[model samples]
Structure formats: C-alpha cells, structure tokens
Target: MTSPAPAPETVAHDDLCPICHLLLYAPVRTECNHLLCASCMAQWADASTLTRITPSSLDMDLSAFDPNYDPTPDLEAGCPMCRTLTAAVPDRKLAGFLEARYPAAYAERRVEEETARGSRVGEDGVQGMMILIGNRHRAERGGDEGPNKHNWTFFVRVSRPDIVKEIRVNLHPTFRPPRVVLTEPPFEVRCLGWGTFTIEAELVLNEPYGWVKDGMGSRSQSLELSWMLDFEGRGKQGRVRAKVKKLDGDADHPIDVDARASPVNLPHMDHQHV
Candidate 1:
C-alpha cells in the first residue's frame, strides 16, 4: 500500500524556495543539498556577481570593468543562504513532491513556463493554446482588480504559415463555426453566452506536405479545450472564476493553462436573455 500524500499546509515550509519565500517552482538542488527555484537561482547568480564587484560608494564607476571578470571564478554560483558554491540541477524528487503536495503552485509554475517559452510553441510550430474570456465590464471600469480581469489566452500558430490554408474553431454544441477563416495567431472570436463548454479547434494545412500523400490533398489535426467557469452571485452582481483543463496533446507537452476569478458586475446585462 502507498502512503497518503501530505497536505499542502504540512509541506508548505519544506517546499518553499529559500530565496523567494514561496513555494518552489522548477526547483533545482544545489551541491550544498539546498533547494531553490530555478528563476531565483538565476536572479541570485546575477545579484551575487554584483555584490562581489559592486562598490559601496555610488561615486565610484565600475562600468569600465568587465562584469564577467570574477576574481574567484572557482567560487561562482554560491548559495545565498549558506555562501557555499553550488550548481543548479533539476530536483526531480522535489518536483514530484510539489506536484503531489502543492498542485496549485505546480500548475501556476507550468503556466509561467509556457508563457516564457512563447506560449508553448514548439520547434514543429504546432503547439497548445490558451483561451481567455475576459469580463468586458470590469475591464472598462478599472478597479483594484488588476489588468487581466480573469482572462488568460494561449494558442499555437501553424508551422508553415505560408502554406497553411485556414483554421476553424468550434465551440462544442452551442455556437456555429466562425464565418471567417483564421489566418493569424490569436484566432479569437466574440460571443455573448454563459456556462462551461468544450472548444474544438481544427487546423487545416496546405497540400503536398510530408504528412500528406500527393493525392490525399490537405492534412489536419483536431485539438480540444475543456474548462470550467463559475458564477457566485446573481446577475450583474456576481464574480466569475475560470480554469483550463489539461490540453489535448502528446504526453510530453509542456503547456498548462490556469486562471483566477475577477469581479463581474453586469448590472445592465440580463442572464434571462443570455
């Protein structure tokens, strides 16, 4: 029998990155056996270099000096806490622990990685996508709520942009296919409706391609997006929460989309009509 997974609260302190004081993301193990976020390590490496050469007095100019010219090259990449030289290597064990113990944090990290990698677009140029549904009302009337207003968008463009014919996006069981063919990256559409649904996207590639036979003409693949949205209160006075499900792709795919709720004030809009 397997042991039960530890609660997030129980593993919070152990899983936190020392540098960020938050849950570890893309954690790496040091030679000193300490774990830190990959991003934190990168930032610390730069800061450590600055600390080594930075003059205490602002009057001094160090611009002419080479930043990479370290007096003690062997002592580079020291741990901020222990001051012990260390190397950053992915801690698979710690990563698994975080995935099991703190799934939300892990998911958030995945989203950030995807965004940093240009929306998870791969070498093949066929990549996963994120669909963002924003509250127009909240966007128009600025509030303490930040810019997004519960919107997150991700999508992949055709590899051979020149040869690509068209793209079709179908919102399962409800809306009709868009009248126009998508020729750009966004592939977005506008509609007024509520309730969660599946988004079926179809990509049509040009003919004479490697994947297609000479007589077979075009080639295509279908990707699906299924997510959830919730409304907490009555019409126009409620909040909206949304999240994206695991994308439909190969096992090794790196894209993971997530979202947070923003206040949805639709006093003028009626759900009865929707």
Candidate 2:
C-alpha cells in the first residue's frame, strides 16, 4: 500500500504576502521591512499607486487645508501601504525557507511564476533549496576580550519548523562543545564571541521531508550549510549573497501545486501585510 501523506507545513500569517495573500513567492523585503512577492510589488508599481484618497468627511474650510498633505504614493516609489518610497531587495533566504516549509505551495508558485515570466527550471525537480543561516548581533560592552565583542543570536527562519527534527550548529573548535544542537522553532543560538568565524550547521529533516534519494521523497531528509560571520557592527547583518546551492540535492516530491493552499484571490479582498 502507499504511505500516508506527509504532515502539512504550518506558518504564521506574517509569512503570507499582503498583495497575493498567499505564502510569499520570491519575497522582496522593502526598506520599511515589509515583505511582498517581487511579482506582486511589480504589479503594484505598474498600476496600484496609492494615489490620493477621497475623504468622505473632509472639512473643506480654509483652516482645514494643511500645507503638506500629500497622499499619492510615489510612482514606483515605495511600499504600497506605507509609502516609504525605496528600493526592494530580493530575499533569497526567505525564499529558501518557503521551499523547505511549504513544498507543495512553493512548487506551485514556482511553476506559476515561471509560466508568467516565460522562464523554466531544468527537467529535474525545482533547484534544491539550501539551508539559509540568518543572524543578528548587538554590541556587548562586557565581553572576554577581542575585536569581535558582541552577543549575536544566529537563527534559521524556515517554515514548517516541525519538519526539522533538530539543528546542529558547529561553532569554533575552541569551545568545550563545538557543536550545539537545537530542537525547536526559530532555531537560534545566542553566543558571545571575540572574533569573526565560520559556522557550519546540519538540519535533520523529519516526516514529510526526510530520507529521500535522487528525486522524490520519503519523509526523512537533512541538509548541511556553512556561513561565515562578519561582526562589522550596527547589525548591518550579512547578506544572503552566498553562492547558490541546491537544498539537500533534491526538491520535495513533485506534488500537484493546485492540490493544496489555493493561491487564488479576488479583487477587493485586501489582505495587506501590516
């Protein structure tokens, strides 16, 4: 008999794009820290400018008129809701997170995106998604001693965290236990360091994403990654500009995208990501 279906992935509403109201596909983080799909933002720039709104109850008196009351969103300016008017960068790490957490949904979006953009992936499954390591640090006034005096919390923002059985982080060799194992959502490791160093991690996959070979999947899978830390300052944070690598050498089984997480939306269903 066939095996039971893998457990469905879970994610917060925040992970959903405001425009499409679906898990973000190719997320682009605006300067204002709002995340929306690149495609959706492009459409907004092309047509959905937050132009002046007609106030149903405006005081049309001379005293009510303010000198600086501009409401129209700048053309291709900024986020539609906030109107910050700045550049939006592609968030590769988040995209990877989506793939690992929402395989079916991500695949569907990938196909839809490719079709819309007239692009295509190799016959093989979607490019394997890699484990992306993310972190944030703050200046630590009281540290042992060294130029790298900060307390940084390294974290992985993968969705469907349950699929990850455990996250093993390999720290500097000098530490008593160079390898640290974490078993929980928002897998994070807070550490005090005095020097910038490279960190390696291995994530063991569980049901739904584990132990698959050469394509397709069974339910037990794992991925390994390494990211070098740059304690420059001001939490500028390292970029996800690292070399591209496939996740676990294969994507989740090629499940029909339409089978889950319906991505369809109707006009007037404004579910902005506030």
Candidate 3:
C-alpha cells in the first residue's frame, strides 16, 4: 500500500516583529512590506499623534451600495522599523502559514496571547454564535487554464448578526495580515491561494449580550471558532452573484446568481479592494 502525501506547510524561520522583537502573532503587513504583530502595530498606531484620517478598525458595510465601497487607508504612523506609514492589516495569512510549519511553536505563541488576554473564555457552555465556513475557486481559464493556480476565498457567516458587535476573522498566517475584523454584515475575508487552509474567528458580542447561558446553564462571553475551508461544499459561496462574462470572456453567465463555479468579489473584504 502507498502512503498518503503529507500536508503542505510554508514556514517562516524566526519571523519576528520589529517592535516587539518577538515571533509575530496575529501579524500585520505594512505598506512598505514589513511584518509586525497585530497588537504591536495597534499599539504603534495608537501612539501616533497624526491628525490625519485614521482608519476605523471596524470593517464597514455599505449595504445600500452593496458590492462597491472604498477601503480606508492605512494608519498614519511610521513603522517602527522602516518609518513607513504604520498603516497595516492583520497578516493572518502569514500567521496561518507559520502555524502550519511550526505547530508547536505557534501553539505556544497562541497560549501566550490567550494568557495575556485573560486565558480562555469562561467555559459557560454557551457557544455564543454559529460559524458557517465556505469557499469558491475559479480555474485559470474556465478549467482550460490552470486549476492548481487559482485563488482561494475563505469567509464566514454569523448565526446571530444582531447580537454580534464585531466578527474578527483569523485567517491562516499564510495570508498577509491574516486577522480581519468586520463590524458590519456579511463578515468575510478573501485571499489568493492555490489550495485550502484552516480558518478561525471570534464573535465579540455587545457587553450584556456577550454574557450568555449555555444548555448546561453556564455563562461566558467567548465565541471562538475554527473550521476548514471546503472548496467542494455547499454553503452559499458568494457575496453578490458573480459572472464569468464580467470576469473573463464568458458573458452568458446566469444572471445575478450566487455559488457559481467561479471567483467572486464582495464589498468590505478585509484588505481586498474588490
């Protein structure tokens, strides 16, 4: 019998943040192509006294505008290392990649983070909200091009949108600025990749709503979740209906239909303009 192949892993050898001088955790990418831990970047940006338009951390949803919206610019602080604009987004993709290549070390980093953040959420038995994971991949040239070289879009849906104050997506570190926070509806993230990877997120509830009782009658404000991206699954795989015609030369796409076997674009995508 032949043995199965091992999973792919892209490791970063001692990828440390310039500010913290520690392994990048929930890292973010600066415009100058520099990597820094998300918390470190946040602190740096916060320390900035720039009177410019600081981007809001809360991802916005222009519901009426639907699929088109402007992305806020990066913060106006000089990077601690390069003195470039501190503008950065969570480099969850890199985090994902690092986690894959250094599972034990990455796990230790996660534990450190959790510890600094008050350890685990109270195990009140309450799950907080349900997380639905989905994905859609488009071949290079309508399946005639390159199938192995396609983009992978990973996203999530919240069970209780009303109570969800914010949805923070922790993408596989393989993606730049792998962490994303959505303050509006249709919480999701898009990244270009060839294969599937893990996805994680947490739903931060509005104070009182955050506290809840579970079936076993316990209370906690934790709604952390993890899921694998399924390219061959059915889970409403698109934000707005995407057409191959507008995409490439296939014009006769089904009018305004979601879940086509093609690529998709939606508004408010973390670090994604289209």
Candidate 4:
C-alpha cells in the first residue's frame, strides 16, 4: 500500500495569518478583534456595500425623505463594508470615500479574484468541523433589491493521529470588515474542506491599540470565535492540538493537533464562546 501522510511539523510559535492561513501581507483589524486576508477583506467589504445600496427610481413620495440625512455623509467612508484600518491610509477618511465610489465594477471582479485564490486546495477524506462565520451579497446590476447577505463558513479536520478533547473554538462576527494594506505583516488561511467550508484569516488588531511595525515592537491580540467541537477517537486515544499562523510562498505552515480521552466516544456538542 501507499505511504500514509506525514505528521504535522511543530514550529517555534504560532505566527501565521489565521484568515489566509499564510503570511500577513498588509494586515487589517475588525471591530471585535479578528484578522483577515487584506485583499480578501477588501473584496468582502466592497461586495457587502454594493449589495446594501439601492438606487432611487425617482418616483417615491415625500415620506421617503429624511430631513437629517445628507448624501455626502453616506459617502464619508470608502466601501463601508471594508472597514479595517491600515498604514498606507494616513487619512482614514479618504480611503472610505474611495470605497464608496464605484471603482469600475469592483464587486464582480472581487468574486473572480477570490475564486481564483481558493482553487489551490485539495480534497478532504473524512468527517470534519465547519464554522460558518459571515457573508456579504452585493446588489446585481439593473436591479433595486439592494445588497443580498452572504455567509462565510470555516472547516477543520483531524488529519494525522486523531485523539480526544472537550475543547471549543469561537469566532465573533460583530465587527465590520477591515481595509486591506500592502506593506505590513501578512497572515494565513487554512483550508479545512473540499467543497464550501473554507475560510480566510488575517491579523486584525483591536481598536485603540493599532498596527505594529515589523522589527520595531509586537502587539498582543486574539481572534474572537463562536463555535467548538468535542473530538473523540474510536481506537487507541491520544492528544491533539490546533494552532494558527501565516502561509508564505510554497511553504505550508505546520499544525499540531493532539487529543486524549480513553475508550473515546465523542458525542458532538455545539456551544458558542462568550
């Protein structure tokens, strides 16, 4: 028979991007404090915004008017959906303005781009864990239905040496998407499935804290999650661990998962992290 897959390599520390599961290229932060792929964040935001807006048909009544509303205020931030902060934007307000403007059909382009990047992963062979996070739906052209909402999902599996544990994982979606940067640290995105449960990760810094300069100083942050799973081995039980990091060029960041529970009989349970 063919050789089995090798065990995951252990590194010094978990330093990869949780979103892209790669190196943090240009990082951005969410309101609840989670990281994302800079470019992916940008597309998600743009798509969300385009899906949220509906053009007036010029045939409505006076009740539709809000005296306190100003069209200028709505355009205040560029792509309100893409809300992460970055260094290239010295004037944060300016970036928001640009995002609001239609950049030659950016939404469609974003979907295509994301699809191309996602086509690189392989298939899964067994039962796994999936986390559906958030999704955005952009409005289709020639329509007044506004933007449709899409949901994002993440999947994880026990590849090598399965074990047992009662641990849980959580992901918070209350924060707005962040802006994409170009010259800062990079992040990673782990592919945990074959069909539709893949997620992109980024290094999002909490508000009032700010981005850290490379080689200067490091910032402490944690990703907010919302789900957990109880894994139990069917045969001889052991230990397993899950970690996050960024993915560089052709190099895959290593993951170590060890679980332990004798006579394993893991009954799956669902719980959200507070």
lDDT of all predictions, in order shown?
0.40, 0.51, 0.48, 0.26
How far in Å is the alpha carbon of 125 misplaced in model 4? 20
Which wins on lDDT, candidate 1 or candidate 3?
Answer: 3
Candidate 3: stretches off by over 4 Å: 1-131, 141-147, 211-216, 233-267, 270-274
Clashes of each: 4, 8, 25, 63
> Distance from true position, residue 257, model 3, in Å?
40
lDDT of 2 by residue, 1-274 (tens): 9999978767579888898888888787777888887766654553222212122221122234243321111123447779766546668899998888899888888887777642222122121122335556677675465343567766654433445567767777775456666777657677776666777766665533432222122223455566666565533222111111123444533311112121221111111111
The positional error of residue 30 in candidate 1, measured at the CA in angstroms, is 1.0
- Candidate 1 lDDT over 160-189, as tens digits, reads 344433444444344332222455544444
Compared with the true structure, the alpha-carbon lDDT of candidate 1 equals 0.40
Output the lDDT of residue 143, model 2: 46
- Alpha-carbon runs more than 4 Å astray in model 1: 1-11, 48-75, 113-274
Candidate order, TM-score descending:
2, 3, 1, 4
Top TM-score prediction, candidate number = 2
lDDT of 1 at 97: 80
Q: Candidate 3 residues 1-274, lDDT tens each? A: 9999756444444587677676677777888888876656544543332321112212322333323221112334567887765466556678898777677667877887667632222121112123344555453333666444445555555444566566667666666556666777767666556656667655556544432222222233335555566555332231211000011222332122212121222334644212
lDDT of 2: 0.51
| lDDT for each residue of candidate 4 in 73-141, tens digit (9 for 90 to 100) | 111113223444321112234334333442332343345434654311101101111112222122223
Sliding window of 10 residues with minimal summed lDDT for model 1? 235-244
